[model samples]
Target: MNIYRYEENPIITPADIQPYHKGFQVIGAFNAGVAEYNGETLLLLRVAEQPISDDPNKVLAPVYNTGTGKIDLVELDRKDERYDFSDPRVVRDVTQNATFAYLTSISYVRIARSKDGHRFTIDNEPFIYPSNEQEIFGVEDPRVTQIGEDYYIYFSVVSPKGIGESMVSTRDFSNVTHHGMIFSPDNKDVLIFPEKIGGKYYALHRPTMKSIGTPEIWIAESDNLLYWGNHKHLLGLRQGMWDSGRIGGGAVPIKTDKGWLELYHGATMEHRYCMGAVLLDLEHPEKVIARSAAPVLEPEADYEKKGFFGDVVFSCGVVVDGDIVRMYYGVADTSMACAELSLQEILDSLVYE
Candidate 1:
């Protein structure tokens, strides 16, 4: 099967996106969640902000201080440290027990509007920020779904405590009701279903266990949006496959005659991310009907192959229209890109055998 990408897509760029944090400068502005509201396409961009460094000798990042409502600059010594800072995504301590931390990439959800879903106008202010102590480190990827009149947004909130999914609701963009932390730590990539089934809410979640199990997509049932339980493993990485390293749910599940169609991201042991799809039973959300034997999208373009973090095509959202699926994805963990594929073509590629 063949997939199509928009040559003129990825409406926003670093040059077009404005910085959200006052003192810190914006760096990675990609992997945004998508939604359409009031005749406009809205993009919830993951804007990574850090201090503007002038010194060639040090790496500086901004940490939020809630009490002061300001960001504090944290400096890392590149020369003295035993750790190697060669990779943008990971930092390795060579002299020690091989300790590492993914360099600080705090995310703020900024808004950009599009009338045609190709050309967008970004807002000067951010829609969400890392305000409280729990979100001091920063917020990362976000997934948005609209059910009825209310819009439900789920995102990863990061801090010293741990990383987990949080929620907020809004009818209009003017006001948002923050429900705070909905899912516990060691969890993220939670995509709530657009509608409830059998009076129970359904969501696709990933529970991160570094040693025990790789990041896998699971289904969870909830009576209320705040509490979630009754988990069932939906999908996992295949050995020596495109998704051998880890997997997470991408755009919110799309309802089709076949089932609940989900587009998700997977990575290799080297952390090269790509996009694929899975079809699940409508009645029993945990039952997987079929899955794409191969990735629908991979890092082939120049922008996708090289950037802040290269060889990645991570997606957080999509907008479906009739038979066409307009996908918005993060390129190389640095820039936002878009592509279009046929809904039927993607479904036909799913292999049950």
Candidate 2:
């Protein structure tokens, strides 16, 4: 798989962004949603911030206090046996059975503008932060779909209630209208189609399973974009292959003559993430036609293999100009990077079903 990585990779990083408030520090600036507004390339970045704490005896977390409408820090004693520090992202309290009990960092969607697609200027404030109880944990991995005059945005909402997907729409990016949670708990990686098909809207989502099945891409159709139904399992993991563990929708699926080209991320049993391509029927996106055997883009660079979550190449969006596919992706869950691939090359690499 030939990929032309930007010479100045990691166009945005934690060090490049300032903390939203004083006691906090930016730890990650990645998993951005790509779009074009006013002839400028736009990236809706997921900026993660963690509280400053040097004490070895204490672990600090960020929580959105719904009552006060502000994020407050929650500190726990490291000596406490009940605090499960297994996942670096969350300080899970084994005593409680509920998720989103405590998160190590809180993320918000911020804008980063670029003229040349590689060089970006990070914005000061968050474009979309945790505004409701459902977003108490944080808003993350946003996917934007432009239809007519409106840009419809949907993202993952993490909270004590459960991890779900929510929707928001904007035209100028200055103002937004929140449409509340579209998909319920334990479901995320939702991507709405750029346009409707067969007089209805389409979407791709991932529903994580606990006992019944594995996480795979699923297709859903809606009449008004809010009320969604007719969900069908679209893509499943290929056992013993690159995407054997789990898979999720990445980037808004690009429309091509070949099919609805979807660049998705898949992880191994070891949690190593890589990017691959799949082709779906344009008229019937639920019917996938082709997919990659090996990853088109994987964690190979030193920067991609080391940081917050190492060996990961996850993306939320891409920009397709003519035959060139410019992919804006997150590396190691720490920084934003860009790479270019041939549209024909990616399509040719796929195995037709």
Candidate 3:
């Protein structure tokens, strides 16, 4: 195997960070956006929290109240005939097309400072919380790209309206400027390139369809960082392959001499998520050059197979140094983990198509 798993494996867990409130408990601390700033490594962790209930049947959901500008805990009965609380993650309205009623847990981005890139100290307060109406449910899976001195963090904002992409930028990690929904609802896993190409900014995103089409990677161009257009369908699932189930952009596409190397997460029909590689044309990134016949990384470790959502290795970011790519990924949707891969090795793994 080309993967060099960190000896410590999961470096950050839910126990490492405390919940923002008294009654709420931290359920997950993973799916982080990684960046390097001021001689330290930063993990923009997706901290998931839910209200602790004494009664088993009483399910409490925290919602960001747009009217009062506060998070209101709404209680629901598991035994209620109009709803289905079978899924521990979400409550569904049995009355209306089995739609999502409320999320069992809410997620927000937090900064974890690591001087050595192994050990980390997590912050108590959320760096980006559910502030506006767009993030009523919460923000999840942040992907950071450094352009010049500022670090731009792109994340998912889940609300009753739908899941969308939102961005925020920080220089020192202390403060940030909010740039509202970059892509509208039903679009996520958006990764913006570090620099503009051909005097235009480029990005990779996945927008799901309701009645037609499977989840596939798409490319878009932007003049400014905010407004995006010139959308093109990039990659789709390969039948009977590891990514036959679904596919999305993982780490930010790394510029290479051969081409633009992208690390993406693909799932099987059984919902087993693994990491794969793809190579794109240098100038026109929308043109695909090669793809992975097999997964570059999969759920081999115990931590990757057992947790909040098992059989998953989802990466939001990585820190690159020459040939060494230090990948920080969320394990089973529970904790954060690190692995080192040679950039050349990932490129070599791709099969030219």
Candidate 4:
């Protein structure tokens, strides 16, 4: 795969963003949703921020208090036998077998604008934040689809209840109307088709199943965007492959003369994430036509190889202009980057199974 990475690969980083709170630091500014709006490229960045803690033996977790509309800080002692701090991202309580974040960070969506696709300027304030109980944990990994004059935003909402998919739509970026949770708990990585197929709305989602199922991509049709059904399995993990561990949908499916081009992310058991492409039947997107045997984009550069989480290249959206596909992706789960691939090149790289 020929991936022309931007000269300034990491176009947006934590340092480029302003912390949401006074005593917190922005840890990640990646996994953004891309769209062309009002003659400018718009990036809906997922900004992750954690409370600043100077104490070596103590960890501070930031929790959003829905009642007070403020973030509450909780201190956890490292020596506490009840909790396990083995993972840098989360703390597991041994007694209850419940996992929680160590340096608890809240993720919110922020906007970055650019006249050209390369250089971007991040907004001072967040575009969307945790406002209700469902998103108390945070709103994350947004995928935006423009249908007619409105742009629909689909993202994961995390809380104590469980992680689910939520939707909201906006015409002018300033004000958005929340559409509530569309998919229930234990589901995420969702993207809606820009137009209905076969006289019904369609979506691609991943529902994490504990038994008799693996984390794979699935497609469903809906009469209305709010309720979806007629679920059909789309793609699964390929054993002994780079995507052997898990797979999920990435950018909103791009329509092409060949098929519905979908850029997706797959990971190895080692948790190294990479981007690949799949072509779905236009009339029946549930049917896969062809998939890439190898990754189109992977962690190669220092920026992609090292960060909050290492060896990762994940995308949420892309912008296609004529023959060029501008893919905006998260590098090492830390910062945002862009790469260009010829639409014909990506289609040529696909191998039918």
TM-scores for all predictions: 0.95, 0.98, 0.98, 0.97
lDDT of 1 at 5: 70
Task: Put down candidate 4 lDDT per residue, 130-198, tens digits, no spaces.
Answer: 889988788899999999999999899988777899999999888999999999988999999989889
Worst window of 10 by summed lDDT in candidate 3: 62-71
Regions of candidate 1 where Cα sits further than 4 Å from its true position: 82-84, 89-102
lDDT of 2 by residue, 1-353 (tens): 67899989888989999999678988899999988999899999999998889897888888888899898888899788777887888877677753436888999999999888978888899999998899988999898899998999899999887899999999999999989999998999999989988899999999989779999999999999999999999999998998999999998989899889999999999999999999999899999899999999999998999999999999999998888999999999999999999999999999999
lDDT of 4 at 324: 96
Candidate 3 structure quality by residue, lDDT tens digits, 1-353: 47889998899999889888779998899989999988999999999999999999899998988788677899998789999988878899989888898999999999999899999998877898888888989999999999998889999999989899999888888889998899998999999999888899999999988889999999999998999999999999999999999999999999999988999999998989999999999899999999999998899999999998899999999999999999999999899999999898888878998
Worst lDDT run of 10 residues, candidate 1, spans 96-105
**lDDT against the true structure, each candidate:** 0.84, 0.91, 0.92, 0.91
After superposition, which runs of candidate 3 have C-alpha atoms over 4 Å from their true positions? none
Give candidate 1's error at residue 243 in angstroms.
Answer: 0.7
Model 3 residue 175 distance off true place after TM-score fit, in angstroms: 1.9
Cα lDDT of model 1 by residue, 1-353, tens digit: 55577676445667676666665666788989898999999989988876667787777656678999777766777795676878755455687566444345567888889999888888888788887877877788988999899998879987767789888888987699999998888899999998888899999999999678778999999988888999988898999999999999999999999899999999999989999999988878889999988899999998899988899999999999999899999998788989989999999899984
- Candidate 2 whole-model C-alpha lDDT, 0 to 1: 0.91
Which clashing pairs does model 2 show? none
Off by over 4 Å in 2: 96-100
TM-score: model 3 vs. ground truth: 0.98
Give the per-residue Cα lDDT of candidate 2 at 155. 92
